[model samples]
Structure formats: C-alpha cells, structure tokens
Target: MGHRLADTSSPARLAAPDEGIGRDELALATRNHGLPLEALRYDVTPPGLHYVLTHYDIPYVPDDTAWRLSVTGRVQRPLHLDLADLKGFPQVTTRVTLECAGNGRALLTPRPVSQPWLVEAVGTAEWTGVPLRLLLAAAGVDADAVDVVFTGADHGVERGVEQDYQRSLPIDVATGTEPEVLVAHAMNGAPLPPQHGRPLRLIVPGWYGMAHVKWLREVAVTDAPFTGFQQSVAYRLRQESGEEGEPVTRIVPRALLVPPGFPDFMSRARVVRPGTVPLEGRAWSGRAPVTRVDVSTDAGRTWREAELEPDDGRPWAWRRWHFGWTAAEGEYELSARATDAEGHTQPLQQPWNRGGFANNLVQRVPVLCLAKEG
Candidate 1:
C-alpha cells in the first residue's frame, strides 16, 4: 500500500498569516510543550524542561517486566526480549540532539496547521541503550530485507488514517555504525521518563523526532519499503497535496540563541543593559558537524563570526558558540546563523512546504538595550 489519502477532507491543513492560530493548534500546543528559550543555557535539557510532542496519549505501562520487545519478520532468528534482557546486552551511551521536523512550522507564512511550533521543539540528551544493529545482527536480516519497521505502542488517527505510529529505516541506515541507532531505555542517565517513552524508545540520532518511535515494542525487518502512514503519507516534503516530495531525513542545520537578558511576562522580548554584553548559544547539524556560527544584531544585514567551542567528541550532539556584543543604548534585533561542515547554512528566509518541515530560518530576537544608570 502506498500514499493513503483521506477520501473526505482531512485534518491537516495550512493557516494563512492573518487567520492566526486556531483552537485546535492551541490545544495541541498545550499538550505538546516547547523548550523554554532560557533553558538553552543547559547542555542537557532535563526531562520536564525538554520539549515533548506526543501524537497520541502516553500509554501507561505499569509493569514493564511483562513487556517484551519483539524482533521479527524477514529474519532467521526472531527474538522476544524483556526489559531486563535488553539491559543485559553490552550497553552504549550516546549524546543526541533531537529536533522536531516542524520546529519552525508556526513561523511559516501560511503555517502548517498541526503542532504549530515556533523553533523551540528541540533538546539534547544522553541516551543509553543496546545498539539496534546488534539486535539485527543477532536476528539475521534476510537477504532481500529492504526496510526495518519500528512499531511503537502509541496509536492514533491522522488525516483519516489510523496507525500504530510506525516508521522505517532503510537496511543500510538501520545497520550503519557511523552514528549507531539505539533501542534506548535511558535518557540523561535516568530510566526513560513516561512522556519520553517509559519502557523503551527508538533513538535515531540526527533524524527528526518522528523517527524516534517511543514506547517501542516491535522491530520488524521487511522485504519491501514500508509504506505505512508516517513513512509515506506523512513526513514527506511535499508542496502540493499529492506530490511525493523528498523524504524528510537528516536534520537541516539549525542555530538557536539563548535569548539575552530578562523577558517581559507577556511580550517575552529581551532587555539588556548597555556595555559589552556576552552572547552565546548552541548549534547543530545532523548532516555534518556545525563548523561556523554567525551573529547578526541588525537582522541579517551584517554578520559576525562567533567562536565555536571544540567538539566534545559526541558526533551527534550540539556544539556551543560564543560572541561578544558592545551594547549601545538603543533598540536592536538579534539573530544567529549556523553553517555545517557540509556547507549547509541557515536561510534568512524560510523555505515553504506543506508540512513546514526542516525550516532552518535564522533565529531573530528583538532586544532593548537599556541605558546605564549614571
């Protein structure tokens, strides 16, 4: 089955600039929280402060002891392993930065009508689990296996299609060792939080958050490309309704600023005292290491290179960058732009798509430089 479309109108739609956020989007925002810009100061976001977006309800798993992760289909040796059994495998820990494909959806001119995110749907965390390749090796992927489908316990309906929240990886990506994917059971050194996928989750470093199937229970190796809802109908980069656009895979390069100074309660604009002000933030690229970060205090009119910190050896994690600004007493605008080793850079103007995926527009912040008390 390929490209399942909703016969009668669908839930997914786009909102024009003047229409504003609808009630449905607001409700989704209430449940799916964004990372507070201030929390960008931390290298690893705490569970609560980290962004959360659940497509369906968080399934309650009172007893994970009885739960078994089944690895089946197109494999010689199918296996069912319990939580303890998974823990028994030789463990590897990885630091990963997961960003929602729709991180900047709300900022789009005719915004995608789903999550309504405004660039805060991201967080970096230390993930611990058994490497997915190890399990595949043990199971013996069939000669004709093409895609490995991951099925999570969370189930829901989207665009008139009901699915169990499934996604797949090509055989090469599923087995690659370069950035080893994990059947993660721990986040930030602690057992997975309930919202983060209590018993288990699939962590595909560098890929969008949708690829990280949470509350994972089944890993099925398939002989054909998996055309389930997520893999085909959703998450594609289509401009028109039925176009099968490019697949949204590795994350595009993105840089976020730690909003300077304090925020007003409602407006949330920044206020900085006049003088030399320290500026810093994080940058990451799933495509390659973030090689450069540029700061622009006057929108994108001019840019200054910020010093990048040496990579901490975590290939998939975000890197910190710093810049200093001589603050004169005046109103100003601020922004950060990132470039990856692959030469991909943030676009000053966001590229539009139906789903609003991979919108790496430079982050612009408004700042009021207060005069010093004489």
Candidate 2:
C-alpha cells in the first residue's frame, strides 16, 4: 500500500481543559463536580462531554511526526500507514452509539470497582474513517488466522498487570462486510478529540466500547485467539469470584426517557401543566434492531406503544421513540422499556454481576400533573 503524510496546514483545535481531579473523586462526583452532564439533555445527539468517555486520567496525544499504524503477523504483506495514508483509502462514515461496559455501575447495590458511570456514559456520533477490512485485505490474512488483535497507545498497570490497552475479535467479525467496521479518524465532522482517541481508533459497531480500541497503533493477525489482559481479564461479566466470565460483547436492549427538565419542573416540583406532553427518548441494541418501545405513565401497571422512528439501517445507531400523553391533574411514575428483533427485552432489573456490566434495567421518571388555570 502507498504511504502519505497528513496535511498539517490547518491549525488544531484546543484540547478540553482537564479538571485536575483525582480518578476516585471524578468517579464519585461525576454528576456534578466531575465532567458536566448537561449535554445529555439533547434529543438528537448529545454534545460536549456527553459525546465521549475517557478511561484513564490523561489522554495520550501522539505527535504526528512519530505516529504510525502497523499491520503484521499472518499476513502476506506487512504494512505501515500514517494518517494521510489511511485517509488516502476510500472513506466511509456512519453514526454509531458507544456505551462504556460499566455504564450503570453506580446503580449497582454493592458497586463494582471501576468508573461509576450512570446512564450519561453513552453517546452517539457520526464517525468517518477507512474500512478496516480494506486494510486487512491489503495485508492478505493467512488462511489459518483465527483472531485479529488490536493494540492501543494507552498503557498503565491495571489489576496488577502492566500492559497497553488491547483487545481482539474473531477474524470473521473483524473482517465482516456488513455494518462495516472502521479505523475512524474523525468524529462529528472534526478531527477526533484527544479524549476520544485522536489520529486513529477502531470502531466496532454493535459492540461495547471496550472492543473499540482507542489510539490504535498495531493490528496483529494471529492463528489463535488472543488472550489479552483487557479482553480476557477485564470487561468480562462474572457472576462470582474465580470463575472465567463471559466476554462482554453486544450491548443489551435499553430504552431511556428524556425527562422534561428545569422550566417544566420549575413551575412546581415534578409538575407539568395538564395537557398533551410529548414523551421522547432513544432505544438501541447491539444484538438486533429495536423492534418496539413501551412507555408506562403509571409505573408498570399500564403500558402504551410509543411511535418509533424508521430505522436508518445502521446497525449501531439508536432509534428515537415518542409518545403523546394527555393527562389530568395527578401523580405519575413514567418509565420506558425496549424490545429487540431477536426477542431480547430490557429487564425490570438486570442480573447482578461482579463487574456491573450490561445493566439494561428499565428507566423510570417521576412527575406530577397540575390542572391548567381556568
């Protein structure tokens, strides 16, 4: 493959300011003192801090001069590519939602040992990049290849092991043609932010964020399955101690209700004027398309099918759903649940796991309806 240098004529955007808070403090106070959460209020795609999640305290910023992505092992042609070289290949863009594996860990009873992210840890973005399979095909994978290992630039000691962030997928999944995977270089029409993995990152549509390795530097094609620390040790769902847990893969089905904030509640505590209030939110699944969304205005006692948006056919993107409610003065406990095409549905309560991964429990919102002034 041909190699080229990236155009450096344009000035880079300023990086987001780091709050200088310790990891523990940031995790505990995320809703307020940590990264701001106001962006999550948006209906289409959340903006600012809501768009990305960073695992470590500091994000790695690579110098363009020394940065390169290498593909080796079990390939007919080993290749080294720079940013411009990757951009030279045909570019593809798609909108995908990414959620951290430990998204709802804060809600867990005993709490898991990780970033205590609530629902705000998820976001959707339009990503632009080169198809990863193109690069893999250029390398000509060996017939015996079983797994494709991805190694990121980020490195540190985790769970007593000092290693770079890495993970792998089956060769078929990595090289699949449908719902194409990307070596993404841009997010929301801009060069990726440092917090979201600048220069290059892997985007494994339909999988948890852990499978999308950031600051990607190496792709190793192997004849056997990879047993990397991030893949085999962390990000796995374990029911108890000492048992090898199932690898956290596809996202479970979930539906979120966007509450009517501030002004609506400011008039009265959790109160909305009696009228037709439009209830809306997003629903998604990694295993299959979201087939339906059910909304409940009186806890789980009564339910109504919400109008769902037409799927754009992007497997990784979420579908927006809406329900119009005409209410009289009363108190209501609103909630939403989603069902997927594969028959998987959001549960009232997700099974307790040691890592608190895949917590797709139904979300509820409390509201009081006040009669309109005569």
Candidate 3:
C-alpha cells in the first residue's frame, strides 16, 4: 500500500486529567478497530471480525507471485525465497489468541494518548504457515546470533523516528518451541487479507500483537539487541517519563463478560429480565492457562466462581466460562476477573504505564434489571 508518514513529530503524552479524547487519538482510533465485546462468543474469530492495529498503511501486494522473503545477516546461507519456496517447508496451523498491548488505555485516569482502546482489542484464529524455527535452521543461523530482526515492508514514522516497521526476537525465543513462532501465510485457512499482512506475516503465539510483524520483507540474524524505535523507545511500560521501562511482552491474564441482555442502542448498557440469567464470557493468559474465573454482580464487592469450560487443548487460545445469576429489578454493576495457572490474576484497578502497554484491568458493565409484565 501507499505509505503515509506523520508530517510532524507525534510522540506519546497523557491527556489532561479532565480532558476527553483528542482528535489525534481519534484519528488513530479510526485507523485501528477493536473486537466487539460480543464477538467473544465465537470460538474462531472470523477474519473480518478480528481486531487490527496497523502502525502504518497496509502494504499492497497486487500479485503474490512477486513477493519475496529474504533471510540474511550472520547466517551460513542467505535465503531469497518467494511464496512457492516457503510453502515447500512442512506446514503447521496454530490457533492463537492475539491481543493488543494497549487494550485498556482509555480507562486509565490520565489516559496515555495512543490507541485509546477500551479492553476490546483482541481476537483468535487458526494461522497456517511454516514454523519459523525451520526457516532459521535452513538459513543455518550463526552460533553467536543474539537476535533476529524482522522488517515489514510498511514504513512510517513514530515519535519522530522514521524507519521501516521492525521488531526483533531474542535467539532463544526465535528458535524455541515453547511459543513456536510461525512465518504465517494464511489466516483461518485462507490467504491473509491485505490488512492482516497479505502474502506473509509472523505469528508469535503468546506475545502481544506487535511482536507478530505484518507484511514481512526481511529477516536478519544479528549479534546485537535491536534498538529500533518500536523495540526500544516504544511498547514499554514506564510509570513516569524517561525510564528504560520494562519491555512489554506476553499478554496478561484477563476476563471479559458478554453484556447480559439486550442493549439500549445509544448507551450500550444492558437490560435484562428479573430472574435467573446466564452469564458467559472468555478468559485467557499468555503466562499460563486460566485456572479460574470469578464473576462479580455487585461491583466486585462479592465474587462467585464461574464454571470454566473444559480446556479445548489450545493453550494459547482464550477459554470460555459461564455463571448463572439471579436478578432483581434494580440497577447493578457487573464485573469479571481471571486467574491463570501461573498464579497471576487481573487487578481490579488497572496498573498504569507510560506507553499504556499490558493494562489488564477488570471489566465493569452497568446493567438494569427489569421485570417483564403482562
């Protein structure tokens, strides 16, 4: 696609405490779309329904035959492979749940001013491609390789750093089997759509979306850590300004409730009948499988364990949970929190970071319960 760079510097900043969303943030919002809370009901998110956050314009590939993936730098043999050659490697299809790092930024008190997502930037699908480990093996990575830098064709400027969209994986992660990264060419059994990275992309199973570079063009094995803006200056968790912040990596534990009943069109608040009602949602974690989910109908003052659906065997995919609630005619607040096997649980109050990365806060839904009369 055509590239569009920010004409001026665009850096991250927090909104005024009393302020509303800025036009710039709205502009970013228009470019990226979050998954609808209701789409959680689907086991495999339709490609069109999946959430997407493109840092730049989607790269245009009019013909798949012409695209090439080059593997170079610190390798015994450099590879220049087109689509046909990549497909020759043994293929794998993995079902993964991907979530944006800034999923709940808008809810922060002095919201960090980027991608104002409100807990809906997530989705899951089966990705099919060659395992990346195989590609590196074929390239014969040098023994001292420290990191593998991936460059996507989409170019843009961020925080005044003009460069190609890029990210790097440490040698262990790049070659590991735990997350089993993929050089994905297909999503949900079909060729990737343009916005999802068209001809090819990367799928880092447990990591947040950014690590999965889209519209990939180059893979370079390096002996040094990548200091690209996206890697070092962005996607970090800093409480204040100018700290070498913790690197934002995997997805944190989170649970979200599907609004219980019919919604009031303008306001999206739930309206339910006064009776026992079924409540269901999805929970997931990149650190481990969600072991338990707790539902709170009275604003988290009290919590009841929800029955988690038996594991479907896709560890990296979100699992479903259901709880039944007896309702009365009144206004109520609803919430859900998850605890993964690693003992990590979501916080009721969001943990803040300068870049708005990994903010896994519990969700609150305002619901009005009314009686159905003859």
Query: Which residues of candidate 2, in runs, are more than 4 Å off?
Result: 1-25, 28-51, 261-270, 370-374
Candidate 3, position 247, lDDT? 88
What C-alpha lDDT, on a 0 to 100 scale, does residue 264 get in candidate 1? 85
**Model 1 lDDT-worst window of ten:** 1-10
Q: What are the per-residue Cα lDDT tens digits for candidate 3 across 282-304? A: 99999998999999999989999
Model 2 lDDT at residue 333: 82
- Please, what is the TM-score per model? 0.97, 0.86, 0.97
Q: Clash number for every model?
A: 0, 0, 2
Compared with the true structure, all predictions reach lDDT values of: 0.91, 0.77, 0.92
Expressed as tens digits, the lDDT of each residue in 265-367 for candidate 2 is: 3533356778788888888898889999999999888889999988776678888888998877988888889999999997776567877788887866778
Alpha carbon lDDT at 246, candidate 2: 92
